[model samples]
Target: MIEYDSYGRMKYDPQLHFNQGKTWVDEDIDYLIHWLEIIGYEEMSLALGRTEATVRDKVFKLRKKGLMKEGDKSKRHRKLLGRCKDEQAVNY
Candidate 1:
């Protein structure tokens, strides 16, 4: 069964998220970059079977490493495009 926190947010479940806490594979990172450009973290999380937080963290690390640009359109305008509203709310 699914579980939620007191705040009504779904808790992380290893059974549901097989990659949770595991090392990311190269292909996974490639797919992340590809999809991240076309979609928001929320959709990318669902597609990658990862938590949204995990996806966001990965993006941050990528940016810090110079793997992703700070000026990337996805990062600059995802909220303006009406994508990832949930993520935007969390950031605020």
Candidate 2:
């Protein structure tokens, strides 16, 4: 089941039956990027079943390592082309 905190950030229940392999797949990362493209980092956390802080931390690390591009930092609300919104480094 999808879990949420009092503030609405998504939470995970370790007691819940879990298949680690299925829970943390490459596609999940893609889903996070997709949500990051839609709403923003904070909302992407909820959509991807993680805390906003966790999302931000991961994004920050990825950015620091140059795996995630600045142009892909947030969803584009304007007409800014030539930016890659799909290219991403695999994260495990």
Candidate 3:
């Protein structure tokens, strides 16, 4: 079940987003990097059990560290459309 704020926006729920505010493990980071290149933020968030904001923030940090390239929305869109080959298997 989901709860909403007074403004009708979804409220943050610990039960739904259990990893919120938790330290990211190395495995999680690896998974995030791999999937991030192929999926959009919302899909990545749901797969990682994290909020979209948190996922975006982490992606920012990873890019800052030279760990990831700038995400190309068009590339991801192509992948979603099955136009690109699945180069890597999705672990999560």
Q: TM-score of every model?
A: 0.62, 0.45, 0.66
Off by over 4 Å in 3: 1-11, 75-92
Q: Which candidate gets the maximum TM-score versus the true structure? A: 3
Full ranking by lDDT: 3, 1, 2
Candidate 2, residues 1-92, lDDT tens digits: the string is 44444454434444332322244467756665455656775446545565555766666776788766665533444321122234322121
Per-residue alpha-carbon lDDT of candidate 3 for residues 1-92, written as tens digits (9 for 90 to 100):
45433433333557556788889999989999888777776567667777767888899999999998887756633222121133222221
Candidate 2 TM-score to native: 0.45
Q: Please provide, for model 1 over 1-92, each residue's C-alpha lDDT reduced to its tens digit, 9 standing for 90 to 100.
A: 44444443335766556677879888989998767867776557656777767887898999899887663553532322132434422221
In model 3, the Cα lDDT at residue 16 comes to 53
TM-score of 1: 0.62
Please report the candidate that would top lDDT against the real structure.
Answer: 3
lDDT of 3: 0.66
Candidate 3, residue 71: CA error in Å? 1.0
